[model samples]
Target: MPSLSTALARALTVTAATVALAGVTALPGAPPAAAAPLPPGVVQLGDGEPCPPATLCLYRDYGFSGPAYGIGAGYAIDLRWLPMPGHGGPTAADNVSSWVNRTAGVALLIDEQGGRTRPLFPGQHLEEPVPLNDTVDRVVW
Candidate 1:
């Protein structure tokens, strides 16, 4: 049989491992245990504005108004490729104010090609202005 000290050390190791795992699971950006459902009555469009199903949409105004852009699945669009609506055709870079993710997978807002990325969960919507607004240069599935 192991000595008393050996048994105590083993217990401590197990306890420490459990605590570490708990911390990791609680960390930000960890995958959720289950996907969350969208809130009730949250349609893809409002006031005839369009945010089509199975697409990731960006808006130039809060509350999903103003110029809208939609990206479909299996795409990695650079914001520079999108034009600002009615603004002399300026690139849409750093111009997105709100967004909705209607696709079945997460969407990522990238600051630069292969740079920092923020995840927009599937079926998620953000009506308010985002800090990453106008700073996003790329979107990827």
Candidate 2:
């Protein structure tokens, strides 16, 4: 025969253990108890533009019973004409590269949270926050 005090303590310990186990199961890391459905407004990468001149891309994992979601990549591109007096051959390539560099810097900040969007070339890197000199001239179109 157990004392009342001992029985109470054992019951409390068992209850505590069960509650603790339940808590661990509810944690974000735990697999949800009945697969959750994807949230509304979730989208595939390139399905929609995040903002004007900006693009957003998403990475998904479909193996889970629930719809997949992950951090997305966003980018922006702006094109403008730089006045060149007469030259137009190599200068054209230089102008394109310059524009790409500027836009890439902005994209870096946009995609920094996900670490996506990289330059096709080896020497390029993403820039965070916006560059101080990235002034833009709006096109009439």
Candidate 3:
């Protein structure tokens, strides 16, 4: 049987896709955190080195400054097997703080507890995901 998160993720994905197809990225006066997509071509411009084209970079610190574990486009990676960068835990499973999505499509952020929480579209990023900080376990591209 699928997990609670799996079911929730499927439902949310469909809803998000439907909303995106309807050209309704956000509601009137909705907070930034409530919406996933800001606008087409909306990139999160911040500090730190630029991410390479066709890759998703997950940083260990805010402002994009820290050791990054980048996954190339078109792949799903489990964080438990990867060690976190300096000044962090043993694994990247719950240590990432920010991300830069340079892949061709949206990247799904799955929490360490096996929940697919949200999608980070291409060129979208959060300096610090308040609700998602240090909880990501998988990157589904």
Candidate 4:
């Protein structure tokens, strides 16, 4: 079974597809929307030194929570799984810095419902949670 959030996302995506098939149109002479500006330190992928492949970049939100319905209001910085480049595996710090540069202060990628990037506070490493031998899936480059 899909996790609650995954199920919700799938539902939303379906609704969006239905709406799109109904023939909604955009205003003329408008440029395509762009992703939200990265918070001061966030860097674009493939810039500067490249991260190693086989490693994943995970984005973690630092703080924020509220009395919201569904997903139980936690001010979670969105977490994104990004793949690293690999000839040789990159060091942990290298991966951290690359991800830090790309998503230190941002929310997860949003690409539905008229398409816009929702910006969030920032991401901080979960030092206390510490490291583990686990893996994640990637959503973007």
> How do the residues 1-141 of candidate 4 rate in per-residue lDDT, one tens digit apiece?
899999987876676666556743222333433343442323333333332232223322112111101111122322231223332122111122122212433333232322434232233222112232112111223
Question: Which wins on TM-score, candidate 1 or candidate 2?
Answer: 1
Q: What are the clashing pairs of model 4?
A: 43-101, 43-102, 52-84, 52-85, 53-84, 53-85, 53-86, 61-77, 64-75, 65-75
User: Which 10 consecutive residues of model 2 have the lowest summed lDDT?
Assistant: 59-68
Q: How would the candidate models be sorted by lDDT, starting from the highest?
A: 3, 1, 4, 2
Better of 1 and 4 by lDDT: 1
Instruction: Give the number of the best model, judged by TM-score.
Output: 3
lDDT of 2 by residue, 1-141 (tens): 999999987976676667556753243343344433333322232212222122222211111111111211332222122221112221111121122121222223112223333332222222222331122221111
RMSD of each candidate relative to the true structure:
15.8, 18.3, 17.6, 18.6
Ranking by TM-score: 3, 1, 2, 4
TM-score against native, each model: 0.58, 0.20, 0.60, 0.20
lDDT of 1: 0.68
Native-structure RMSD, model 4? 18.6
In model 3, pairs of residues that clash are none
Clashes per candidate (backbone, < 3 Å) = 2, 0, 0, 10
Error of 2 at 111 (Å): 9.4
Candidate 1 local lDDT, residue 61: 74
Q: Distance from true position, residue 141, model 3, in Å?
A: 2.2
